[model samples]
Target: MRIRLARPEDSAALLRIYAQYIHSPVTFEYALPTEPEFAARIGRISETYPYLVCEENGGISGYAYAHRQAEREAYQWNAELSVYLDAAAASRGRGTRLYRMLLDILPLQGVRSAYALVTLPNAASERLHASLGFRTMGVQSEAGFKAGAWHDVAWFVKDIAPHDAAPRPLLPVSRLDADVLRRILDTRG
Candidate 1:
């Protein structure tokens, strides 16, 4: 298996993996985005954040990414992470590998804190986050309504970098040194 930076062209395969969670409480998205829409999302997100995909046997097995946790300027140092795997890839450690890489890369982008929201009853996702050193902050009961019922979401957080009194401005993923970025992606756990 290999983890690499995602390109817009990989959207179709990534979208296929993401669609699996649309109907389930694993994700809050209620609709499957079109290939073009997903491709555009890749382009927009890659501009400032790390967008990664894990491929195995010449196919994308899973994917993970981090985005701004909130819009305000003070929240720039915080990011929210998401990961999705094809049904066949579950329980195979692909999600862990993908998240590990993402956690490694985020600090380089000036991200100090990484967060994740796991919908209730997803034991696998909860285990994954906990295993990665993320502590549960709290749960928002009935945070979302989907699939004919209400779902609760648990918030998990981990400090990826030290919180300094004065932090240097965030560096976009695009500005990271090419060699360093490549090395991070090539390094496997």
Candidate 2:
């Protein structure tokens, strides 16, 4: 399996894999995309956020991405991460390969830390992040509701790099910045 930057052509497969997370067992309530919206988002997101996917035998098997953890400029240095692996791809090492690639590359692009909010009691998801160096950021029981069920959300975080002790002003050089990523994606077309 190979982990690489996601391409425009790979969006369909990426969407399919993410949609799997909304099904039973996971029971996530987010609505899956309609065909038209799916195409538009793939074209939109793959450019800026450093979205990535894992492929084996020429088919995408897993995907991940990073986005602003908060909207304010003061929160610029931190980002949230999302990783979803196709069930068929899990336990076969695909998720690990893909996430490692993302973690390694994103920090250099200006990401200081990446946070993940997983539904509570999700050992598999929690363990995956822990093994990757993420520490628990605690859990909020019944923080969200989906499909008429209350779900606990666990927050896990990992710092990508060691920053200087000085509290520096947010700048492009301090980290590539999400805005920079936004610009990069715009250039992909």
Candidate 3:
């Protein structure tokens, strides 16, 4: 598997992987967005953060990204993390590879803390986050309704870098040198 930055062209494959989670309690989304909407989402996120996809044999198998944790400027140093892997790609360590690359890149963008909100009973996801040094902060019971029932969400957090009283503005992924960005994804933990 190879990890690289996400492209708008990968939206269809990315949506396919994400739509599956919407049906299960793994995600809170009720309906899948249209292809154009999804493409716009990819474009919007890549503007200021790291949105990555893992390709295996030339097909997108997994993806991960970090977005603003809150809209307020006070939250600039914090971001929410998300990851999805195709069913066929699960159990092959693709999620780890994608997530590690995302985590590795966010700090370079001035992110001090990264958070994940995982739907309850998702042992696999919880384990993956925990294995990467995230600590369970708390669980929000019945935070969302999905699949005709209420589902809880577990919040986990990891500090990627030191927090300072004044943090520099986040650096867009596009600002990073091509060779440096390539090395970041290609080098393994």
TM-score of each: 0.98, 0.79, 0.96
> Candidate 3 residues 1-189, lDDT tens each?
778888888899999899878788887777898889899999999998989988888788889998999999888888899999999989778878878888888888889999999998888898899899999999999999888889899999999999877788988888977887899888942
Better of 2 and 3 by lDDT: 3
Task: Give model 1's TM-score versus the native structure.
Answer: 0.98
As a whole number from 0 to 100, the lDDT of residue 27 in candidate 2 is 42
Give lDDT tens digits, candidate 2, residues 61-142: 8877776788897666676777788888788766666567666656655567888888877778888898999999898888
Best by lDDT: 1
* Residue pairs in clash, model 2: 47-185, 48-185, 110-176, 120-152
- Clash number for each model: 0, 4, 0
lDDT of each: 0.93, 0.69, 0.88
Please report how far candidate 1 places residue 111 from its true position, in Å: 0.6
In terms of TM-score, which candidate is stronger, 1 or 2?
A: 1
Report the candidate with higher lDDT, 1 versus 3.
1
For model 3, the stretches where C-alpha displacement exceeds 4 angstroms are none
- 170, model 1: CA deviation in Å? 1.2
